[model samples]
Target chain A: MDRNIARLRNRLDGLGVSLRPHLKTAKSVEVARCVMNSPEGPAMVSTLKEAEQFAAAGVRDIIYAVGITPAKLARVAQLLEGGVDLAVILDTVEQARAVAEVSRQTGVRIPALIEIDCDGHRSGVRPTNQVQLVEIGQALAAGAELRGVLTHAGDSYRGGGAEALQHCAEVERLAVVDAARILQHAGLPCPVVSVGSTPTAHHATDLMGVTEVRAGVFVFFDLVMAGIGVCQVDDIALSVLATVIGHQREKGWIVTDGGWMALSRDRGTSKQTVDQGYGLVCDVNGTPYPDIIVADANQEHGILAARAGSNARLPDLAVGDRVRLLPNHACATAAQHGSYNVVRGSSHVVEAHWTRFGGW
Target chain B: MDRNIARLRNRLDGLGVSLRPHLKTAKSVEVARCVMNSPEGPAMVSTLKEAEQFAAAGVRDIIYAVGITPAKLARVAQLLEGGVDLAVILDTVEQARAVAEVSRQTGVRIPALIEIDCDGHRSGVRPTNQVQLVEIGQALAAGAELRGVLTHAGDSYRGGGAEALQHCAEVERLAVVDAARILQHAGLPCPVVSVGSTPTAHHATDLMGVTEVRAGVFVFFDLVMAGIGVCQVDDIALSVLATVIGHQREKGWIVTDGGWMALSRDRGTSKQTVDQGYGLVCDVNGTPYPDIIVADANQEHGILAARAGSNARLPDLAVGDRVRLLPNHACATAAQHGSYNVVRGSSHVVEAHWTRFGGW
Candidate 1:
């Protein structure tokens, strides 16, 4: 995790862009501190629950990346009044009006950002929707600050190779920058131009017009990231420690206690070249057990089987063998547990325990 | 939830079988209390944490349905010593011997059940493995009590219609009963014979040879159950309430705030006749929105799109329109949230908030 943080920080530093690491993956105060070690500290949060947690941990600046709804504005106002520089993102005029009304009613200054659609993946307005962007900007009434624009190339996860990632990152950067330019030309304050996705942030060649880059999963790279050519399987930092409870000898299956409940149901690597079923099984020391993969899972049991065509002699695993599992997606897997049992040394000794919060 | 509980209880009463409702669905004391309202107040738990929770809630007779691991035996012993009649399941002699060792060392009698494989879906020894079953039964040493057998026809989730479900229920019944008969023939005390799956329990014509039936996901029936011909869509008790935040008008998509994080990524209905993508979209009143389905989902955004051939005009969904989503799998979806904002009557008035626990 420390190495991953350093790699991203050093890369962003060289590119003259601030790293606003998304805490949605870790959701821990200690992790946020490590990621935001720079002089200008800020972070991106996906939910209001995350903003509350980071705010309590003394993170002054937080961008709630989800598009805001009126029902949740009072909670945002409460956070704003509590001395946190919390900003929200929106793409529609109705949302902008709601934010303005909430701020006006509460007498709290709410910082806002226009979410620009980069790769047509999830939420955000198209960069070319100048009229709608200007209208949304104009709708930011009293006690509201039109901060800038942000975009996430969420579709970057679909393709493979560094070239595809680079192209996606460029699209993300240009879209947000163009949106910021449009807002600025319309006499709106466009200071922070943010863009990211773990894949894009890792492979982008340049960030000329972007001021801040946000990425989450790189801190604990998973099978999906490795499948996309971002990092190798060895680079995955997070894994679930489980115990082999039984075996289906005839079927050549080793049953483990780590099911979908422990490993998560995120099959992010299903579309990749090597479709890792649930996860790749490994030894306690984090060494990959070749050919063994969690082929199927129940609520509390995982069936570990050898990959097809790899009919090499299977290990003689007993009833109480302990094994580790590498996840398909770091964000989903991390959210399954309340805390992480950190192991710092080569001996796989229990070091410090870090707690993470979830749910909204 | 109360209605669903009553319906199941009445059905099981007529069949003369004890219903040991699996509390894995709604891991709440309140829901458990409602489910255990009958004279036979015992409940089945998936995790030790649940056993602890139910024990604290005064549920004396509890069964930890998952296979036992030696590492968790001490905790089981602790619960046993606390006056809870906690029984655990295992299919291997190694596990049985470990349990026997722990029981002998701690001097706290641990009741054990042999998990019989009725279907080739997950854990358990096949019913035909009589020698192995007898060996496992005999492996129970000084402080261990062999308490019969249990089986879950987990593959009942596959294919639709009442005929398939009835066949699955019969298989589950006969397999567990046959395992018990073998154990009894070997001079082992085979008192209880348990078998079930939500679909099987609902469609089973007879439970004559079975002492108890264990079924989860029936309390909050989902699309999977509906697809399997066990329950209708209206029988689904749990639904995620979300707000329509944006739209891709040209693509006929209504973007919602309820994403895979909120609605879960369990695509259990993908193999069904009707492939409801992420979930079936409904209005706030719990009425199904005609031809609308969650076509795609991100971490925190659900794309509500019209079905392929359905050219019906979608109702104008404003930015703040609230909608409800019926999940693909109740167990997986319900695990995503900490609590359920329960509503009663057709008016959908939220009468109470019931908390549900998660994590192993």
Candidate 2:
């Protein structure tokens, strides 16, 4: 955990950019503390529920990264009133006006960031859609301060290698930075230019115009990250501890107590070169078990077999034996459990339990 | 909820089999009360945690359907000693001996069910493996009571149609009943003969030898069940309420706050006749929006789009507009939420709030 935090922090520092590590993955206060370079530094959260938890934990600066809805404004007011330096995102003029109206009604200055779509992957206003961008900026400026613009290069996940990742990183940087320039040209206070996704953040060649980068999955890299070449298989910090309960010897299946309920139903690696079935199985101490994959999962049972179509001899594991399964996506898997059974260093003993906050 | 309960109860009553409704779906005490045919009737649970919750709700007869491990015997003893008529399943002689040892040590008469693998879908000993089955029965009878055998037609999920489902159901019934016969012939008490899986239980032609039918996911039918022709789409009782947060108009994507976190990472319909993406999109009144689906999902954002490769028009949904998404698998989707914001009849008004217990 410490190494991952340091790796990202040092990289961003060298690039002369701030690290606003996304808190969505590790929703624990302890993890947030480790993620932030300083004790009381800014961090980004994906939900208001996270904003509430992180704010209460004394980490004041927060960015509710998802586009805000009017119904959530009242909750935003509570956070602001509690002295939380909260910033919200919005792309539509309707959302901007609503945020502004809520800010006006509550007499609280809600900081807003214009969400720019770098890639046609998910939600955001196109960076080049200057008319809509300026309109949104103007509307938000009425009752909310225009913090800047931000874009997540979601397509970066589809990238094959470091070359693709670097290209995506550049695209994300250019789009957010260009949006900031347009807003600045319109006389809007464009202070922050944020762009990230684990792939892009780790591979970006430059961050000259970009003020800060935001990423969540880099904290506990998973198979998806490994498949994308952002991290190696050894860097994955989270894994589901499971117990072998049964076997289908003919089919070479080892049934484990850990299923989708323990590991998540995120088939993130399915699109990659290696379609890790459910997850990659490992020994209790986190050593990768050769030729084993959690091929399928029921509500309470995981079918561990040789990765699809492989004729690898099934290990002679018996019932009551323990193993671990590394997740395809750390964010999704971490959300399954209420807390992290933390293990530091090479020890198998749980060092401390870190509580993770969930829900909206 | 009452209608779903009645539907299953009526079906089981005519089949002359008891209903051991699996509480893994609606883990609520309130739902369990409604689901139980009698106030103190038997129920099935996937985890010891659910067994603990249901037992505390005054539902006496509970079966922990998963194969038991030595580690869980202590918790099982607690449930049994607390006057909960708890029964556990085991396929191996090792597990049976462990249960017997625990029962003997605690002076708690643990009831045991031998799991028969009728279909090679998941865990259980084959019914034809008479030597092992008899050994397990003998081991359990030493310090525990052999309550009979149970089998889940897990492969019924992979069956093609009604013909296939009926065949799988028959396979489940015969394997469990044959196991019981073998045990009875071996001079071991074989009483309860359990067989089910939502697909199998609903399609079974003969329940003559079966004592009880255990099925979850039937109460809240999903797209997978609908695709298999087990239930109509209207039979689906659970849906995710989501709010339109933004849109990528050019791509025809309507972004919402319902993400994989709200909808779950269960892409269960991917292999169905109609791959419903993440889920089939619906209006607030539970009306299906033609051709629309939650095409993709991030942690807190669902990308609402036309089903893959379909040039369906993006609906004119603005920010804050509400919609509902019918899940691919109710069991997997329902696990994502902390509680059910239950609505009764045709009204949009929340009639009740039921809490669901999650975790192992």
Candidate 3:
């Protein structure tokens, strides 16, 4: 995790852009402290629950990255009034109007960013849709502080080589930068220009117009990121510790207590070139077993078997033997457990237990 | 939920078999109390966490339905010593030996059940493998109390008409009954004969020789169950309330705050005759929008769109408008939440808040 944090930190530092790590993946204050620029944070979160929890933990600068609803602005105002520089993201004029109304009503300057769509992956206004973008910006500037623009290269997870990732990074940069430029032209203050996704943050070659890069899953990279060439399999920092309960020797399956409840239902890698079924199976020491994966899972039982058509012999894992399953997606899998039993690379000695918070 | 409970209760009562409602779905004590045969339950659970939590709430009789490991026996022994009749299921002789060893050491007489594989869906010993079945039973009888046999027709989720479900139910029943007879032939006592799966429990035409039936997820019927003809769409008792935040009108997408984080990644209905994408989108009043579904989702965004190939027009849902999403799998979706805002049929007034417990 330290190495992953350092890798991105150094990369963004070289590009002359600050790294505002997204805390949605690791909802631990301890983890946030390690990745944040400071203890107070210039962090990003997906839910207000995260914003509130981090604010209570002394984090002041947070961007609630999801599109905001009018009903949620009261909580946002409360955080602002509590001395936290909490910002929200929105794409519509209706949302902008709501944010502005709440800001005026609460007598708190609510900061917000216009979400820009780069590749039409999910939410946000298209960069070329300058009319709606400016309208939304003008509405926010009326009462709320328009804090520039933001976009996520969500489509970057569709794997290509390094060239495609770099192209995606450039596309993401151009989207937010173009939106910020248009806002400036419309006599709106566009101060912050932000863009990211784990793949883009790692592969981005230039960030000339961007102020900060945001990413969450880099701290605990998973099979999805590895599949997209953003990281190696060994670079993944998260795994679910499981105990072998029994075996189906005739079917060549080893049953473990770690199932979807522990590993999550994210099949993020099924579309990748190599589909790590539910997860990749590893020894207790964090070494990957030969061609073994969680072939199927029930609510509480994971069936570990050799990958299809692989000749690798199933390991003689006895009942009560321990194994670690590397997840397909870090954020989804980590959300399953309450705490992380932190351990350093390859060594099983206990370090610390970091608590994780969840809910919206 | 009351209606769902009564339907199964009435069905099982007619079959003359006791109902051991699995608390794996609604991990709330209040919900458990509503569904259990009695306060001191003859209930089933998938995780020891549920067993421990329910036991703490005065649920005495619980069968940990997952195959047991030697390491978990200590916790089971603790529950048994606490005066809770905590039974565990296993298929292998190694697991049986481990349970027996733990029982002997703790002096708690841990009850054990031999799992029979009714269909080649997941774990359990095949009923025809009587030599191994008797071996496991005898191993349990050595120190642990060999209670009986259990089987789940997990493959019943693969949709067929009611006839197929009845056949699956019969297959599940005969497998456990045959295993119990094998154990009896070996001069071992087989007191309980258990069989279930939500579909099988509902469709079983005959339950002769079966002592008890267990089913979860029926408390909140999901799209998967409805697609399989087990229930109607209106019978679904669980739904995620979401607020519309934005829209991509050109793409006919209504964005909501509820994502996979709220709805879960269990696309259980995808393989059914009718696929309900992430979920079926409904109005605040619980009426589903014509052909509307959660087409795709990000971490905190659900994109609601018309079902593919449908001529249904997108509803003009403004920002802050509320909607409910009926899940694809009740168990998986409910696991994502910390609590349920209980409401009666078609009423928006939250009757009570039921806290849910999770972990293993």
On lDDT, the leading prediction is: 3
**Rank list by lDDT:** 3, 2, 1
Q: Is the docking of candidate 1 incorrect, acceptable, medium or high quality?
A: medium
Candidate that beats the other on TM-score, 2 or 3, i.e. the better one: 3
lDDT of 3 by residue, A160-266 (tens): 98999999999999998899899999899999999989999999999989999999999999999999889999999999999998787879998899899999889
Best by DockQ: 3
Which is the winner by DockQ between candidate 1 and candidate 3? 3
Considering lDDT, which of the candidate structures 2 and 3 is the better prediction for this target?
3
Deviation of model 2 at A187, angstroms: 1.6
Task: Summarize candidate 3's per-residue lDDT along B1-360 as a digit string, tens digits.
Answer: 899999999999999999999999898999999999889998999998999999999999999998898878889999988899999999899988888888888888889998888998888999999899989888888899999999999999996999999999999999988888888998999999999989999999899999999999999999999999999999999999999988888898999999999998888888888889999999998899989999998888999999999989888899899999999999989999899998878988888999998888
Model 2 misplacement above 4 A: B309-311
Q: What are the clash counts of all predictions, listed in order?
A: 0, 0, 0
TM-score of each: 0.97, 0.98, 0.99
Per-residue lDDT of model 2, residues A46-164, tens digit only: 98999988888898889999999999999999998988889999999999999899989989989999999998888898988999999999999998889999999999998678898
Give each prediction's DockQ, rounded to 2 decimals.
Answer: 0.68, 0.77, 0.81
What CA RMSD would candidate 2 show?
A: 1.4
Residue-level lDDT of model 1, residues B187-287, one tens digit each, is 88978899978888888998878999888898999998888777889989999988988887877788888998888878888878888989998888889
TM-score for chain B of all predictions: 0.97, 0.98, 0.99
Q: On residues A131-218, what C-alpha lDDT tens digit does candidate 1 reach at each position? A: 9999998898445888889999998987667888899999999998899888889888889999988889888889999999999999
Q: Look at candidate 1 and give me any clashing residue pairs.
A: none
Fnat per predicted structure, each in turn: 0.51, 0.68, 0.77
